[model samples]
Target: MGITKTLNDDLIANRSEVSIAEFEASRRLGAREGVGGAASWAVWGNENDDLTIFEDSAAISPRLRKDVVLIGANFGLGGDTGEFPPFKNFHARKSGGDSKLRKAITGTALEGAFLTDIVKDYPTKDAKGLPTEIKSGTLDTNRYVLSGFKTEQEALGLSRDTLYIPMGDTTRILWDLLVDRGVIPAEQRVFHRAYGNGPLFKERPVTYLRHYAGAVDMVQAVQGLLAQLNLR
Candidate 1:
């Protein structure tokens, strides 16, 4: 097949190449090199406390299939280079003061279209040491920590035709722009429900595209996805 009829348009628009030296520097720690049965709709979420969802949607596209892998690195918090702060600061925090800081940080990071978080309910401690319910809003500054891997998985689900690749802690957003533009068949938009076996081959039918951990993984996964579909 020519570039896999099912490939997404966003994945086609942003494919590129890089040096081997760059590739080695981007691999993630503890990322194993084994393939298994692909879950058609695996959604990643941070701990229950930080339940951010990652998936393919018009709002959060997973720019599937490309040669270049995108990855994210942490520069620190409250600065231009770090990952976004918790959703409370980015979205729900009151206006002005730290709000400006959060906006500045988010705007800079999201300039190229990266996915982040939104505020949610979390647990808190009361004066008597009893567990209390606290909205993400009331946390003191610095209480919000960047989310982790499981959280990333909870937000996004991968199946036969779709995969969730993380660019840093943020899931690289992807949309079915092909469907939006009416380029691909409407029935091919598999993200709305579970992916079917029609997209798979052999036992290891689903292929996950990834690269070096952190920022590089995102680029590598996109590249891998493109290469795979192009061969189809």
Candidate 2:
């Protein structure tokens, strides 16, 4: 009924290894030079103050590790607080709408030539009108999409030209298998942070695992979709 229930059920029933393999492969590709552009941005400090693009090798060298990775959750990183602090409150009512803030963030990332991806989970229906099935691992029946510009100058097209990947249940299972195999760390799990104070903002690390998997799936999906749409 709810997203968590759906994902959990999928994880329990999923039985595939291919998805995880694909996810790892994509991660390798994303990390490769000349495949995807790289840029630096600040990980917001407390209250979003002291913004600084992470440029120092010392600050970013850890990301070069084989196990180090980045997973972009659907919502912004900071979980909601009842009151918006000054720097982090750029999305507050006084500021522009969330959409504006999102665009600004994306724009900044794009300017730095960073690749961005989006992943979403939605229900699947069979001809009989019943929920068809749940997927596991990195790939899920849920849709995983990827989009980004070929170059920083092309960034403007990102808003319109997203590629899609149609992943099935087996894909998700493979992701879980990879996790079990120690290919990806559990801490890299991705989850959406709430925008405002909500019960869901308590910050459970496990819940974000699905989101991390979703990010991997998105990268692969985008590559496939681009080939299919002849946009590559």
Return the TM-score for candidate 1, rounded to 2 decimals.
Answer: 0.23
Model 2 agreement with the true structure over 91-198: per-residue lDDT tens digits: 223323322323333322111122222221121212111112222343332222222112211322222222111123333343344345444233333212111121
In angstroms, give how far residue 30 of model 2 lies from its true place. Answer: 14
Runs with alpha carbons beyond 4 Å of true place in candidate 1: 1-3, 6-111, 118-219, 227-232
Query: Which candidate number would show the highest TM-score if scored against the true structure?
Result: 1
Q: RMSD to native for every prediction?
A: 18.2, 18.5
Tens digits of lDDT, candidate 1, 1-232: 5444333444444333223332222122112111010111111223322314322233222322213212221211232212232222223233232233222222221122222221112122111111111123243211221122223222332122332232222222221322343322344323222222323432333343221222333333333333333222
TM-score of 2: 0.21
* RMSD value for candidate 1: 18.2
Residue 217 lDDT (model 1): 32
